[model samples]
Structure formats: C-alpha cells, structure tokens
Target: MPAPTDYLLTHGGHRVEVTYKNVKNLRLRVLLGGRVVVSVPLGVPEHELRRFLDENHAWILRAQQRMRMAAPPQEQLVDGGRVQLWGAWRELVVADGDRASAREVDGRIIVTGADEEARARGIDALYRRELMARIPALREVWEERVGRRAAGLRLRRMTSRWGSCNTRTAMITLNTALAKRDPAALEYVLVHELVHLHERGHGPRFVAWMDALIPDWRARRLAMRGTP
Candidate 1:
C-alpha cells in the first residue's frame, strides 16, 4: 500500500491540511475543534486541490462555525464540579472509599472512590446503567406508536451522530451521550431511527410520518443541536 501524502493549502487567509490518499473521491471535513482536513486521490494535482478548496471555502467556514458553536464545555470531573444529566445540571459529589460506586441523591450525583479516575469510572458506569434502564421503556412506547419492533438495541459513545438504524436487521444503536441529554431528546432520536425502519430515506413520506408521529420533533432536534 502507498503512504498518504500530507500538505497544507492556504486560500484567502484560511488554511487547510490536505492529504492525498488511495481514494476515489475528494472529501472535506471540518472537525470539532475548527480544524479543516481535505482528502484527495493520489493522482490529483495541487492546482485541482487548491481549486476545490477555493470553491468550498464558504461551506468549510460555515461548518467550522457550527462545530465551534455546538462543542460542549469541557468538564474537569472533580469533586464540586457539575455535569449535565437529562438536560439538567447536576452537582458532582466525590467521597473517599476503597470501592467505587455512583448514585444520585437530592439532585446531585454522588461518586465514591479511591481517587479521581475511579470516581470518573464510577460515574460512567452509572451513566451506562441508567441508559440501559431507560431504553427498554422508551423503546416500548415508540414501538407501540410506530407499529414496529426493533430486533435489538445497543449503546456506545459516538462523536458525530446520536443514533443509527439498521433497517435490514431492525436494530438501533444509540449514543450513550444521550443519557446526558433530556429524556425527550432521547425519545426524538429513538423515533427518528425507528422511522428509518419504515422509510430508509428522509423523503416526503418519511417527513410526513415524523410529523404525524412526533409533531414537536423539530424542536427537539434544535435543542439537540443547541440552537436557540
């Protein structure tokens, strides 16, 4: 296999990292931290790459802006720190103990462990457990409304998408991060993916079904995107 070539391209005072790879198409990605990356076929000339970047300058700028706006504020995950859960802010309480455990008490999340890392892991475990407990009930409700049943459900940490559906297998994989969001937002994602079971694309019929099934879906989506 050939190695990818990396270079930098500057246009109109903006710069983007360009990589030439063994691929058939040109792809542009604006990452979460406002970094711009363009991947092109190995044989593409520098002039062509520059032209492509030039043409898509506005799009790159808008994508970077949106990413910057949507990025969540970083958390230190220490005692007295706060985290968002179910669309609401909750205080984190850390206690000293040999065995790690996490639970919610009086609107605060209490984590006990030997150190910070243990406490963090304890909290993550709590998040996964809570998601597992909530998904079954939510799935049951949406299945009744959509008149379709999912064959399986899975959870994982995802950077870009909230959920995806495998229409072929009738499975839905949800982002574990949803546990930190509003329960209603999670429902919206569940419905959106389940709708994909009936209609694969976001066509008119799909939109119609969503409208009929979850009328306030657009609002929930906007909330997910952190839009006002």
Candidate 2:
C-alpha cells in the first residue's frame, strides 16, 4: 500500500479532498466531485506525470465543470437520511429483527434497523423489486421494436458494466444500479444489451443499428457513465 496524499479541490460552493492510489498503468481519475488527482507507476519521473496531465487537461476541466453543475440531493439515502421515493420525500425508517420488510406504507418506504447495514439492505431490496417489475415491460417494448427473441433476462448486482449480453445464450444481465436512475436509462441499457443478440461485437454495423433505433444513444450512454 502507498501512503495517502491529500489535495484540496473546489467545485462550486463545495471543497473536496482527493486521494491518489498508485497502481499499474498509472492513470488520472476523478470521483464525482471536481477533484484533481493523478496516479503513476512507482518509478515514473515527475516530467512524465506532467506530460500526462497536459494531454488530459481538457478532459479534467470538463469533468470538473460537470461535477460542479450536477446538483446533488440535499439528503443522502443512508441510514436516517431522508429518501425520496416516487414523488414524495420520506424519512428512512429502520426496524430491528429478521422480519423487517421494506414496503410502501402511507407513501413511505420503511426499513427496520439502527445503522447503515440494515438500512442499506432494506433499501437495496426495495430497488431490486422495482427492477424486477420493470424488466418484463422493458423486454416487451424492446422485443417489439427489435423483432427478436431473447433467451432470458437476469438481474444481478454488478460493479463493473451496467449490463451485458451472452449472444450465444441470448440471455441478458442488467446491473442492479440501474434501478436508482431514470426509467429511460434503463430502457436504453436494455436495448443496448439486446442489440448484442444480432451483433456480437461493437463495430460499424452495431453503431449503425443503435443510431437508427435510439438517436440519442450516445448521450444516454454518457449519462449512464455519470458523465455530462
């Protein structure tokens, strides 16, 4: 492990602390906040790091601007953090015991617990149910538009890609995180995955097909990656 380096960065009215991690291939990355951070190999010269930053200067600035512009919710969805569901904001209630179930009661989604762990699980379960219900409707819409049949659909909590398709099996796997974003993004992801049924790799033909179907596919793609 490398010792941490802290740097100050400003984004609109907020100040963020950035920490750099030294790993292989050594690259610069920024989290959601407008933080300037860089990582390099153990023996890389300072001059090389400067060159890398120069080459990526435009990207860094754009990322910072977008992060600053995207308004963050006043409250988080963590334990005791009031969360908005559907159209109303409600207190995140936690209950103890195994029987604690998450369901909408009087326009509020309730969980049972005292800390982050219990509240997170219940909140996740609630989102998972919503995703499950949406999948079938999404599949129907895309199937009609694409005129192709998929082998199946499965939902899983994935850390990497939003969704993936097995062309051979015709089955699609969607990320659980999609449940938190807008419904249109979910539709876009579904279409992207299902299009894999025809084109295994993303080539000119794939782009053409996607462009024909969703004119703003590129914008939608960028939005999914949390880019502006």
Candidate 3:
C-alpha cells in the first residue's frame, strides 16, 4: 500500500482529518475521543469531500456526542477512596488477603488482597464478573428483539468504546467499565452493538433501529458522562 496523503477539513465548527488513501470508496468514522476521520480514494477533490461531510454532518455530530459521553469515573478505586458502582457511588473498603478479590457487601465495595494494585484488580475482576453475569440475560432479550444472534460475547476494559460488534464472527465485545454505569447504559450499548450485526455503519437504518427499539437511547448515552 502507498503512503496516504492527509488533509484537514473544517465542518460544523469541527476539524475533520481527511486521509486520501488507496481505497475505492470514501469512508468516514468518528473515533473514540471524538476525533473525526474520513478516508477517501486517491484524487477525490476537496469540494466533493466537503459535500460528503455536509451530507453526513448530523451523523458525525451524533457520533461525537456519543464518544464524549464516556468521561471515565472520577473516583479512585483505592482503599478508603470512593468508587461508582452501577451508577451509585460506594465506599471502597480494602483488607489484606492471600489473593485479590472484591465484592459488594452492605452498600460498600469490599476488596480483599495484598496491595492497592491487587485490590484494584479485584475491583476490575468484580466489574468483569458483574458484566458477565448480567449480559447473558440482556443478550437473550436483545437478540430476540433485533432478530440477530451473536456467536459469543466478551468483556474488556476499554478507554475508547462502549461496545463493538464483529459482523463476520457474530461476536460482540463490551467494555467492562459499563458495569459501573447506570444499568440503562448497558442496555443501550447492547442494543447498539447488536444492531450492528446487520447494519454495518451508523447510518439511517441503524438510527431507525435505535429509534424503534429504544426511544430514550440518546438520553441514556448522553447521561453516561455524568458523575454520580
């Protein structure tokens, strides 16, 4: 592949990075952290690119809006430090143990382990376990509603995305951090990724699915950024 040429295009008061690549068609994606990038085939004129951006301005804005909503929880996951769990702020209590482990007891997140880092891992393990326990029921409901079934679901702690779908494999990966947010946010992310099984992009059809299934998805997405 040849080295791609890059340029900047300002639209709707947002600076978009346009890369002229060797691809056949133009593609646009709003990455995590709200950066917008457009990949166009070599030799596509700037005027056409601007026109494309104008045509898809609304989608770009919405994607950016969603990206901005994942403002990571502000609290530390240390002993005596506070943390948010399922959209509620809980007191973090840590104790020494042979290995790392955590659980919720009496409205508090209790971590048992050797050190602060271990306790943090215990907390993350708790998040993964929580999400793992909850997603099966959600996937059953959402797959039926969306009329698409994923081959499998996995969890990971991600900095940039809430969830993603692999159309070819029918597998979905969700951010474990979601277990710390409002339960509603998890449902929204599940539905969003599930819909991607059929709709490859967040274009009109994908929006239509979101509108028809969860009318308040936008509100739930925007609320993910708020601190408890």
Candidate 4:
C-alpha cells in the first residue's frame, strides 16, 4: 500500500481535503471547526470527484452549520465536575479507590480512586452497565415489532455513529455514547437498527417503517444530533 496524497477540492467557493485511498466509496467528513475532508478511491476520476463535491455541497453546508451551533464539550471529570447520565446532567463526585468503579447515588455519579484515564474508564463502565441492563428488554420488544431478531450485540466507543447493524451477520453494534444521551435516543437507535435487519437501506420503505413505528424518531434524531 502506498501513502495517500491529499489535494484540495473546491466547488462554488467550498474547499475540502481530498485524499485518494484504497476505499471503494467516496467518504466525506466535516471535522471540528467545519473543516471538510473527503476520502476518494484511487481509481475515481477528477471530474467525478468534483461532481461529488458539487452534489454534497448542501449537506456539507448543513454539517458546518451544525458544527458551528453545537454546544461545547462537557467539562473534564474531576472532583466537582459534572456527568451526563441518560441525557441528564448530574454532579460528579470523585472518591478514593485503588481501581476504577463508578455508581450513581442520590442522582450523583461518584467515582473512586481514579486518575485521568481511569476516571474515563470508570464512567464508560457506568454507561455500559446502564446500557446492558436496558438493552435486553428493548431488544425483545423491538425485535417483535420489527419482525427480526439480532443474533448478537456489541458495545464500543464510536467516534461518529450511535449504532450500526450488520444485516448479513444479524448483529448490532451500539455506541456507548448513546448511554450519555436521552434514553429515548438509545431506543431510537436500537429500533433503527432492528428495522435495518429487514430493510437494507434508508430508502422509502425504511422511512415508512421508521415513521410508522417510531413516530417521533426524527425529533429524537434531531435532538441527539445536538444542532437541530
């Protein structure tokens, strides 16, 4: 494999960093500060790349707008900082413990004996615990509603997406970040993936199913995005 080269793609005064890589798809990302980047397959032609830019111009602008309007990140985890649990902000209490353990008591998250890194892990453990306790019930209810059963579920910290469904494998992977959002947001993501088990893409049929079942899914989605 060769190192990827980067160049600028400019369409209608919008500029993006384009990198030719081994990917089969043209991937676009609006990073922090609204910087645009695109990963193009090595074989894609210059004209197609430019057209991609033009076609996605509106989406890029919206993404930039969202970035600009999104709220600043939460404060660092410390003795008197705050924590997000099930979409609600609660006080953080750092206690004394040799290892990482976190629990919610009296509507406050208390972490004992953690440094910077362990503090993060402890909070993640808390989120995973909450998700695990809640997912089984949600899956049972949604699988019946969607008429498809997921063979497995995995949890991971994702940078971009809340959840993904592997239709071929009948597996669903959810982001732990969802634990930080409203409980309804997590339900929306799970239901969205459950529907994908039968509906392959986010087309008309998918939208219809989503609308029919999770009527307020769009609203939940907008709220989760934090820029709507």
lDDT of each: 0.82, 0.69, 0.84, 0.86
Residues 150-203 of candidate 3: C-alpha lDDT, one tens digit per residue? 999888878888889999999999998898888999999999999999898999
Task: List candidate 3 segments past 4 Å from native.
Answer: 1-73, 226-228
The best candidate by TM-score is 4
1 against 3, candidate with superior TM-score? 3
Candidate 2 vs candidate 3, lDDT winner: 3
Query: By lDDT, highest first, what's the ranking?
Result: 4, 3, 1, 2
For this target, which candidate reaches the highest lDDT against the unseen true structure? 4
Ranking by TM-score: 4, 3, 1, 2
Name the candidate, 3 or 4, with the larger lDDT value: 4
- lDDT agreement of model 1 with the native: 0.82
Clashes of each: 0, 4, 0, 1
Residue 89 of model 4 has an lDDT of 75
lDDT of 2 by residue, 124-149 (tens): 67777888888888788888887777
What's each prediction's TM-score? 0.63, 0.59, 0.65, 0.66
Task: Return whichever of 1 and 4 wins on TM-score.
Answer: 4
Specify the poorest-scoring 10-residue window by lDDT in model 4. 67-76
Query: Tens digits of per-residue lDDT for model 1 on 1-228?
Result: 564488677775667888888889999998866789989998888788888888988998778656744666545466656666787767677877757788889888888888877876777778788889888898888899998899999887778899999999999998877878889988999999999999999999999999999999999898889421
Cand. 2 Cα-lDDT: 0.69
TM-score, candidate number 4: 0.66
Clashing pairs in 3: none
